[model samples]
Target: MEHSHTADWWKKSTVYQVYPKSFKDTTGSGEGDIRGLIEKLDYLQGLGIDIIWLQPVYVSPQNDNGYDVADYCEINPEYGTMADFDELAAEVRRRNMHLMLDIVVNHSSTEHRWFQEAKQSRNNPYRDYYIWKDPAPGGGVPNNWQSKFGGPAWQYDEATGQYFLTLFDKTQADLNWENPAVREEVVKLMTFWAEKGVSGFRLDVINLISKDQNFPDDDGSARPGDGRKFYTDGPRVHEYMKELNRRIFKPYNLVTVGEMSSTSLENCILYSNPEQNELSMTFNFHHLKVDYPNGQKWELMPYDFEQLKSLLSRWQTGMQEGCGWNALFFNNHDQPRALSRFTDDSEYRVESAKLLATTLHGLQGTPYVFQGEEIGLPNPKWNGIEEMRDVESHNIYRILQEQGKSPEEAFNIIRERSRDNSRTPMLWDSTPNAGFTSGTPWIKVDERYPEINVERQLHDPDSVYHHYKKLIGLRKKHQILIDGTFVRLDEAHPQVFAYSRVKGQEAVVVVSNFSKEQTVFQFADAFAEEWLEAGPAELLAGNTKQVPPLWKEMALSPFASYMWLIRRK
Candidate 1:
């Protein structure tokens, strides 16, 4: 493990994620554009972020909102021409900030040239580009696998009389990575972007590229309509990543991160460990899925605090022991807003938001702040299903209604779990459309934008945005936040989540009240002993950003957090 003085830039830097479609829309086309992002680089730099992760803006049919790449080498016209992207790259580098793009390689849009040719005839040279199989004995899909969007995972092509694999939308046919030609193509695309001066790539569903050759049927015990067990972290995923990293990424000094969904910890270690030579880090979805009972995304339940603690602690200790690094994040384009999902956004929005930021940033990993998370954005109580634009949300709503659920129940479900909640236009100001676009937005902007937005919070002395800035500043000034060992304290504590980062004789203690109720500050080792009496100590940060009182016999208010630094000789 590299220490702070010698660690790579990414090890000590923070990343800010931008869901391009909702970041800004400069064209008045009701959609975000690359130029709009270029216009906002200053705002991100002001927040002290080192890298920006832009979602896919490649040419596409928008079936899966840019995940279905129709052309790998070109930018979508809605975003702008390739020249616009080149300009953005130049500007980002001039400011000493790196840029990362999402690479959706597991699948391609049906309209892609290769998929089009593959579907033309069975003997076509491109036929091997994607997975294809003949119909079953009874003229049904090849397997019982279900697409993530809805319906069967296989889409029957009338012209070819074969079913093509589409784990996502029917428009996106899964690529056959076993084909040397397909692997070469993916590698060539990676090289193409790297040559263009892109510093990093976020591989989407990369762990699912390989598959079980037998195409066996699932036992139906997975998530509602999931066939992921057969392909997730499949046989040759690590091998392919090793080859990719050795040839293209490592040479270019590019940081590579894979979006590992439904993956195992063992596989994740190999994926990100430097000794394994696969990826720099991975975005694991396990902790984020704790709220989904039985692995079903549509079915919502109150997030389990203990389950969250268990998963986070396991990954934290596991990855460290395995010589792998993690990418810490709470919200992204695919999940509901963080403050609303994990905290009481109504009464404790600001404090809980800061507490969440403090807890995650205090850990030993590269922290990622999703766009607008610093402002304490909450999930919208979207009026009805019709107001939702996310394909997954609409699909689950339809499925729930077909499963005999009442309209009210289905709408409530969508309200609680829709990805649309995070895709709303960035709340910039109090104006209409939240100052995102003068034209209509692709989706409804959150109604609370007037009260909670960048303009309102950027200047507020005690806003979530400034609090996040303080956390970022602290990480920049302290070495322990990056290189120290982590030990979870008070394993059985119910309400207070406590942990310590220790380096030599000095340590930093982070304690957060995870619930919206007053709680006694009792943990494995209170500050009264080694911290208050046996060593020199000082309060580094708190929800109030003040050392207002003594540490002993203090009642932590709802969503309160405090960090103390201790030094011993």
Candidate 2:
């Protein structure tokens, strides 16, 4: 497993994901822009971020919030111009940091040139660029595939008298990867950015590109169907990924991470394994779905802690054994702030935030910190459906009511589990509009911004922001943390989440109390005896004001977390 200069840097680096729309509004447009991000570069660098993973700022119809890219080569006028992007790339390099752009190649917005031309006529040269099929013998949709948002996955094009595949929104047409021209077009666009000095790419839904050409109908057994099985991690996904690597990634020495949706652990390993020449890392949503009762996202229930522990342990151990890398994250643009979902965010907001940080940063992967997560931003409070901006949340609210749920019942579920929760304006100060905008904001700022803004936390010594800073710095200070063997500690422990990362003689043990009450942590029998009787350990980072006793058996306060650097006797 030899490493190149580019390969070694990503392993030791931490990425900060910015949802450009809600990050900062510079022109009083109520939308974040490239200039606004430029103004905050110093703030991000102060937090010790190595790479800035900017979410889609490409030209789009905003159907899926920029996930449906209309033009891969042009910057959205809503965000800024191409010159602003060039300045951002140059500024990022000036600060000795890298910029990673989010790329959506799995599908293209209906307004994209290719899709527009394809819809003009069946014999159009660009028609083969997207997947289009004739009606089934029954004279309906080409297949029984269902849309992820709602309704049918295939949208009928009257002009062509055919239906096109769209697993997500109908406005987003799936690209035909079987066509070499389509694959070549993707490579060309990605290379365009690479030539502009972009260091990496966060590929969105990349696993679904090389879908089954057979276009088979799905059985009704799977919960998330109309036909995810046929497309997710499809037959030629690995082959396509390998080709991508050879075409651009390897030659340009760019860092790439694939956003895998409804994918398997085995597929992820092959997708990210260095030996496989596919990608640098992968993002899986298994652990995040612990609250999805019976794999249903709309329903609500207490998240299964045991299930969370098992899934994390499985991936940690499995990825480590397979020599594959993972992109570790919790809060993101598409999900609610994890603090609200995992623990008590009311009484112990700061403590629980730090605890979640320790739990993730100590794992074996490149940690991605979403905007405002560093300052302990929880989910926003919404009043009604009018305040909601996410299309998925609105669609689900209607579906819940269609399922016979009362208005109150449906809204309650949406309030708890809406993507809009994380899309609120980033709180920079305690001023009006949370200092995010001077004009009317696209979305309302959370009322709690006055208390949880970054200005207040910046001066506080014991703040979530500083905790994340120290954790990011620790990776550079300790080599063991970069490539340690992940060992789960006491999987049966009900109240605490713990693990150890060992490399040769040194190991870093991370212990976190996930419960509200104080708990005791006893070393599991599987732990090596040498570590228990080891010499005095150094406290690496922790959430508590005062350090706890360094011993095999110790008391852990509510939401208490600590990382200890140890050397086996």
| Tens-place lDDT digits, model 2, residues 369-416 | 999899998888778999999999888888899999999999999999
Off by over 4 Å in 2: 1-6, 525-528
TM-score, each model? 0.96, 0.98
Query: How large is the C-alpha RMSD of every model relative to the true structure?
Result: 2.4, 1.8
Please report how far candidate 1 places residue 69 from its true position, in Å.
0.3
On TM-score, the leading prediction is 2
Number of clashes found in candidate 2: 1
| Candidate 1 stretches greater than 4 Å from native | 1-7, 221-225, 525-532, 545-553
How many residue pairs in model 1 have overlapping backbones?
0
In candidate 1, what are the lDDT values of residues 120-169, reduced to their tens digit? Answer: 89999999999999999888899888887778899989998999999988
Q: Which residue pairs of candidate 1 clash?
A: none
> Cα deviation of 319 in candidate 1 (Å)?
0.4
